[model samples]
Target: MAKVFIYPATSLILSDLVARFGHEPLGAALSIRERIQTPGLESPPLQITPEDPKKGLRYAAVEVPSGVRGRMAIYGPLLEQSEAAIIVTDAEMAFGCMGCARTNELILFSLRQRGIPLLELTYPKSEEEGVQFVKAIREFLAGLQEGGS
Candidate 1:
């Protein structure tokens, strides 16, 4: 199964859909879960370690805001592990909001640079659109299963 990165990594809908389609979903939920569950974590709610910023340096410049660096530390590794990705734009905050526009841009740029299989879709505004959106995602994921680009 392909490892599919869902944009707005916090979207449970996307994460569930990806998993339903038989691919591993790489997103913030799983990452944060790992952090919170780590044996020696001092702050489960914070879900961050002192060295996270240093790890983030691999993805962002040292001069960038530390917030961006910290976020990248979590997302960068997911991007590296992704074999495919599904990105939904113009999504509502409830759908998933990364909470940082700069980090979002960096993540998108990095994904594009990777040249992996990517399916970019617009957030559905109506029931019809929602159906089409899910259909597209399913088709894209099925294509991945078939080893087609």
Candidate 2:
């Protein structure tokens, strides 16, 4: 199965759709879960270790904001692992909010640079558009399954 990275990384709907279509969804929920469940992560609410920022430096420059670096620490690895990706633009906060414009820009840039099988979709405003949105995603994913990249 292809490892598909969903943009926003926090969109449960996109994550579920990717998995339902028989691909592995690489997103923040799974990554954060690994941090939370891992032993020796002493910071409760922060859910980060000292090494997390260091890990992020691999993807982002040291001059970048620490918050962006921290976020990259989580998303960078997923980007590297992705065999394909689905990016939903203009999404509502309820859908998934990465909460940092700089980080968002960086993530999108990184994904584009990777040259993976990528599907870019706009967030649907109506039920009809929603149907088409999902159809497009399903078709793209199906193409990946058939060795289309």
Each model's lDDT: 0.83, 0.82
Colliding pairs, model 1: none
**Runs in model 1 with CA error above 4 Å?**
30-46, 146-149
lDDT of 1 by residue, 31-144 (tens): 223334444212124658768888899999999988789888888988998989999999886687666789889999999998899999999999999999999999999889
Residue 128, model 1: lDDT of 100
Off by over 4 Å in 2: 30-46, 146-148
The CA lDDT at 138 in model 2 is 94
The global Cα lDDT (0 to 1) of model 2 is 0.82
Where does candidate 1 have its weakest 10-residue lDDT segment?
35-44
